[model samples]
Every structure is written in structure tokens, then in C-alpha cells.
Target: MKEKKRILLSLFRKKSNMFLLGILFFLLFFMLVSVSIYNTSRDTISAIERTYGTSFSIGLTPDKNDMNQWEDRAIEGMDSPVRTYIGPNVDEAMVRRITEEVEGITDYEAGSRADVMLYEYELVPGYHAWSYNYFTTHEHHLPYDPEETKNMMYITYTYHTRNSCHFDQFYNGAFRLTQGRHITPDDAFKCIISENFAKRNHLKLGDTLKIDLHSLNVRAKYPIESLGSVETEIVGFFELTYQQTVTQYTEEIDILENWVITDNEAGRALDEIIGRPYYLSASQFFVENPAELDEVMEQVRQLDWIDWKYYELVKDDGLYSQAVKPLRTLKIIMAVCLVVIVTSGVLLLMLVILHSMKRRKREAGILMSLGITGKEIRKQFLGEHLALGLTAFFFALIVSLAVTPGIGNQIYGAVNKGGEQKVYTEKEIEAAIARGENSKVAEMSRNQRTGVEPPKELTTRVEVKTALLVFAMMLLIVYYSVNEAIKKTLKLEPIRVLSMIE
Candidate 1:
């Protein structure tokens, strides 16, 4: 034990050895921190991707002759369809057929709705006038009647109903369940509300709402009448926060309050009640493997009933790619950091070893006189540096475990805060109109619907593989530096060293 102590003291006493050990410790520390950061970033990117299912939209073009012109009327007074005439409208059979023929296709659904009035509830007194104006222009125009205007000025207002059709494949894909249940195939009169929409009208699960459809006849005294009523049992809700704020840039939209989701059964029911041709909305095909998307789309285009000129195939590739790009970027950055750190550490060790060799010229001369072989000297130096490198790496591993969680928390906070802007849903806008409380519905939609629980802090474990890798790298660097130092110090002849001392 005493001899071992003496050797340790002698080894550390060399200034160059001490400097080299310090550099190794710092190198290990930096590398560990960098790796932790990379891992945390990757996890964050993964979470975002998983929440938003990978999907893209296909745009349908209308014939130029069908475009509505406001030749003699104000832009607001011009009666035009929100969307120009596209295809004959997508149907459930077409959506299912496309999915069946495509390999790796998972699920598919489609929805369609015609113009209807969403009633608003009530609004605060201060902003009521502006709210009235907004709904009148953007939603449906409210007719002026001297006697009836006072009665209609209540909190609830009706806006023209826009038609929409949607088909969802399952609960797991692009849609995540936040609250209750998803709109299953069995759900006919049921609908899912957005978080933003729910908050705006103080709506909860199991609420029945009414939508009014207006006939185009100008002489009708009561322009609005209940077309169909939806008994919504909110099975689940979601934060369109990311989608609305990041993707659409429509910060004013409230998802839950404006948008409504119902399955095909309810759609068929609505068509029967309203007595209008339920226009086919957009059809979607969900696929498990993105690589097969192109082939599947081609087959869909070839279907006899599909209108080739008006219809286009849409895939979820763009959304998926965007979700994964961050993770890929983190991987690349980590690799570059690792290379730079290791190379710089090796160079630093070499410089320290070279300096030590110059300082230890006399020690080498004395050792030669004492009959130690150059090879033995080299072995001892290698052992000493190897031990120091291992110690530094172990310390770094300890420090990293404590540091990673704090970094992860900060990242989470930043993402959540950045997503706080209002996210409008078609239901929320409709709800505001239905309730006749359209005062700044956009501003009220920013609240998170599902209230996702905070993620647990990551407990970073020093992975055995990572530790082993670090150890091996440290050993290699120390071995090369110490071996070179020994070779230079011992190049002098033993006889020449002895003569110099005389």
C-alpha cells in the first residue's frame, strides 16, 4: 500500500500528467452533457410527431367558368360558395376502396356538410357590437328588421352554415383522444368538440346543440330553421394548439367551439332531415407505410367514378417529414459535436505529453543509468494515464445524470408556452354563432382543451454501452499520448546519458 501511494504521488507530481488528467476530465464532462442534450431534443421531437399524425391535404381545383363574380354587389353581399366546385364530392365507398387496394393502408374516413347557421350563446356587453359585425360579415348576414332586430340582438346569433364532410380512420392515427371517446363507426348523432370550442361556450360532454339551415329564397320571413340537431357526447377533445398556431397561423380560431365531427350515419341523417343533396366532401386514405403512398394514389385516380380532372391524391408525407426533421437534425449535430470533442481532446493530450517529455529529460537520463528499458518506461506511462482517463470519465457520467432533467424541463416549458396562441376550430366558430355570443371567439379559443398532464422528468441512466464507449476512447487517447512521450524521452543513448552526468 505504501509503495503504491509513493508511485501515485510520483505520477501526479509531474505537471504535464496533472494537466493532461484535467483536460481528460473536462473532455468527458462536455461530451456527456452534449449527449444528454441530444437525447432530450430527440425525445421532444418524437412527442410532437406522435401527437400530430402524419398527413397532407389534396387540393381540388374548380373549373374557371364556375367562379362566382361579385360584379354588381359588395364583397360581403355577394353570394358565393366558400369552396369552388371541385369534384362530385368524395364518398365512403371511394375512401374504403382506395384503402383496400393499397398495401399497408390502415384506415380511412370522409365527411361533408352544407351551408348552415351556427348560433352563438351570449357575449359580454363591452365587445358585443364588434362581435356582431364580425359574425355578420364572416359568418352569415343578419337581416335587418325594425321590429325584430331588438329581439334578435340577444347573446345568440346565427351564421351561415358551411358544408363539410370528414372520415376518420381510427382514434390512434392523426387523432389522439384527450377526453372521452373517439367517434366510432357506431356513433351516428355523436360529435367530438375541440378544446377551444368547449371553453368558449362553457360546453361540456353530453350537450345537445342545434344548427339552422337557411333557404336561398329572399322573401322568406324566417330565414333560419333547425335543419338537424347534434347530441354531442364529448368522448374526447384535443389541443389544436400546435396545428392551429404553427401550421395554419390562424391564431384566432377556436377548434372545439367552431368545428364539429360526426360519422357517416349522422351525415346521412342530416341529409334526410335537410332534404338537400349531401355533397361529397374530401376523401382520405390512411396508409401505414409511406413508401407505398404513390402507388396507392395512382390506383385511386384510376377508379371509374373518380373525377380525374377535379380530384388529386393527397398523402401525409409532408407532415411526417416535418415531424422527423428535428430528430434528424439533432442526430447530425450530436455526431459533429462528438467528433470535434474527441479530436480536440486527443490533440490537447498530445501537447501536454510533448511538454512533459521536455521537462523529464533528466529523469529519463537517470532511469537509463539505472538500467530501465525504454519499453518498460513506456508501459508505466501508459498505465498511469489510462487510470487517470478512466477516473475522469466516471466523474463525468455522475454529473450528467443530474443535469439532463433540468435541460429537458426547460425544453418542455418553451414548447408549451410557444403554443399558447388561439386555435380556431370550425365547431367553435359554429358554436359561437349558435350561442349568439360571437364576441372575440378567436381570443377565447387559446385555452388548452385536454389539459395534457405534465411529462415526468426523465431519469437519465448512465447506459453501459455509452460508458464503455467513453472508457475505450479515453484509453486510446491516453495510450497514444503517453507512448509517444516515452519514445521521444528515451531516444538518447544510455552511454551518452551517463557521460553527460559525469
Candidate 2:
């Protein structure tokens, strides 16, 4: 056994054989590393998609007709007919029906808004930048309440949802919770007031906020005249970052300072006061699997119970699609690269084995003539290639740890040259807000650029399982090539092999 092993080891001592081994080592190394990177990149992209890629929204799809599209009514003193787009209304029942029936929907946010008059507490004055200046320059009278002591009106937002983090103001960095926590679905009649408003009202966490429901305004058509008041416990305080507005309207109620966020029960109580049905102003849904978002949406559409006429299912996946466009392209490129590398590597390896076998044809014939079985001769060739392959595998794994990150990032950077929209993390947004960089956050939100940036650099490493998989595949190909080459060479008779070699 030792003598045979010595002969096998002696093959490596020859300069020519060493050169062949060197070539084989390099080929297998690149092949294994390439495979590892491809897999790692796939996993990274999937994680990004899962974290930031899936979002859906349910919105009103108003009737599209000449009469319903616009209400062309002339005011007694107006010069022209003012056209207004009257959208359809959404109800609590509809929100529940859609959410309950949608299979892939993992979570949703639903909320209502009501404008109310404050009788006891004074509201923080609304800051007007453009509108106030424009009215003053144009000598137009501002729309101030005739009675300064009269109750001030403000809008209150109410929510009952699994995740309140999806709120536009909170999500876009326009508002940050300064004290306490957000309103979750489990909460009932809890409130989150702005810091300025809380200070103005002399309120703190755990204080009760009493709002008069009778003072609710319905587009000035009529006052709510609701006979009751709803009181909510203030659980949170949020700081409203300064905002830059291009277009402005008159009214403190239009600003974020006067806005109050509360639970669904509080909102429902307001509706109950007026003896009116519960309605939802906004509802957002999310899916479990972003990759199958389209399929989930299709399932929602197929539900015959849903009247597509009154409702529209709007997908926020546009940004998701844009964000993942390059990722998807990178995935395809990786797949193609894997195919090309594997196919070429296998073919090249087969040729190398064949050439090496041809060189040792005389040796193989001599061994067979010495009563050595073809199986034993084939095993010797297998052992030689296996040794080289194993060495290359380990070396490739070690070196790949250093190179994969760079190569993976380069591939990602190349495909994402144009760059996707940048979405900030909660911490980054809060930091920007703290620095009074509200305009930056608002601009990002306004442009509908909600797609999160792909990973700055793809983190890739050759995992042990991945390395073993590639090594196993390499060994299989090497074994097949070596066995085939040996079979062809060993078929020749010992005399025939010697004669041909001579």
C-alpha cells in the first residue's frame, strides 16, 4: 500500500504534472467561488425585498362619468363654474370586508378624520408662510374668525390598526414620537397629541382629552350637533418637525400642529354622537410575501363579491418594482453567469483529464499487463484529481471570504448605476428631523419616492454548507471525467498501447 502511495505522490514531484495540477486548481477555485457568490447574492436580495418591498393601499375609485367627474355649479357672484373632483366615500364595513377576505394580507391600517371645535382649550396658532404674505400683498382680507373668543376648530385623526408605523406623517419623518408610544390596534380611546399642543393645553401623558362631538364640521354643510363628548387618555406626545409648503391655505386646522391622533373607538364615538355611520378616510394593507404580491392582488381581484366599480385596489408596488428592477436584473445576470461558468468549467475539466490520461496511456497499459484491474487503475486517476480538487476547494473557500464582498458589490453597483429611490430608516429620519432637515424628508415623501435603497454593500461569505455543495458538485464532474478517460485508455491491449506509444 505504501509503495503504491509513493508512486502516486511521485507524480506530483514532476514539473509538468505540477503545472497541470496548478491549472486544475485555478479552474476549480474560480468555479467554486463563483457559485458561492451567486447563492449569497440571491439570499441578500431576497432579504431586502422582504424587509422593504411589500406594500398595498386601498383607496376610493370615484365614478368616472361626465356628471360625476365634476360638479359644475355657478355661484351667484362667481365669474366661472368651479369644477371639483368629488371622490367616492369609504366605510368601515368595506374596510373590514376587503381585509377579512384578502388571503395574503398580513396587516392593515385604517383610520378616520373629523374636524372639531375646541371650546375650553386653545390651539397652537397655525404658521402660515406663503398664504399670509400673498393675502397681505394682494390686499385681500384674511379669513379670520369674526369672534376671536369663539371656539377654535381643528382636525383629529383616529386610527385602529395593527401597525401605526405606516402613517404618512410618522413614516415620512414629518412627525416623531417624543413621549410615550404609538396607537396600536389593541388600544381603545387612547390619544397621541403633538408636543406643542400638549404644552399649550397644559396636558401630559396619562391626562384625559375631552373633545366636543357636537362641534364636528362636515365640510361646512352643517355642524355635527352631536349631543355627547368623547374623552381619550393621552398616551403619547409627538413633535411636529417644521415643514416647507409651496402652496398654502388659510386656517390653523389645516396645519399639523392642530391635528390630533387617537384610536378607532374615539373616532367611532364621534360618529355615534352624530348618529352617523362609521367611515374610513384611509386604509393601507400589506402582504406577507412581496415576491408573490401580484398573485395575492390577483386573488383579491377574483373575489366576485367585491364591486370593482365603487372601490379601487391601488398597489404601492410601483416603488417596490423600481427598487427591485436592478436586483432582478442582477439575479438574472448571476444565473446566466453560473450557467456559463459551470458548463465551461466542466468541459474544460473533461478535456484536461483526457489529455492527462492520454499522456499516461502507456503506464495504464503496463499496469493492466501486470494483472492490475482496470478498476484499480481508474481509482488511481480518481485519487490524483480528488487530491487536487480538495486542495482547491479549501483554498477557494478561504480566498473567497476576502473577494466575494467586493465582487458582489461591484455586480450590484454595475446594475444599479442609475440608483433607486432612497428611503430613510426610522433612526436616520429622526436624526434629520432633530436637525430641522424637514424639507429634505418632505421632498422625498412628496416625490412618491418610497423605495428603500438596496444594501450599500452586499455582505457575502462562503458558508460551509455552500462550499461543501460546490465541492461535491466539482468532485462529481471530476470523477466522471476521470473515469471516462481511464475507460477509453484502458480499452487498448498492453502491446497495442506500447506499440502506439513507441
Best by lDDT: 2
Write one digit per residue (lDDT tens) for candidate 1, span 1-502: 2334534865768666667768988898777766665665566555644543433334466556654521232223345534334335556665666667655556665666544334454322223334445555574655653333222222222111111122231222333446766666556566665566567678777876544333321213432344444333455564442343321212322222345565556556556664645555555555554445666666666678666676676664443454345345555666688789978888887888777766666666766777777876666656667777877887777876677567545544544343333456657766776887756554544443332222334334445666676777777777877777667457878776555542
> What's the lDDT for all of these models?
0.54, 0.67
Relative to the true structure, candidate 1 reaches a TM of 0.63
Candidate 2 lDDT, tens digit per residue, 48-116?
667656766667677657466567655333467666655456765666677799788887778877766
List candidate 2 segments past 4 Å from native.
1-7, 48-89, 99-107, 112-163, 166-178, 185-234, 238-281, 285-303, 309-326, 409-449
Clash statistics: count for each candidate: 53, 0
TM-score of each: 0.63, 0.68
Candidate 1 regions with alpha-carbon error over 4 angstroms: 1-10, 47-83, 113-115, 118-181, 192-210, 215-259, 268-284, 287-340, 361-375, 407-462, 483-502
C-alpha lDDT of residue 153 in model 1: 25
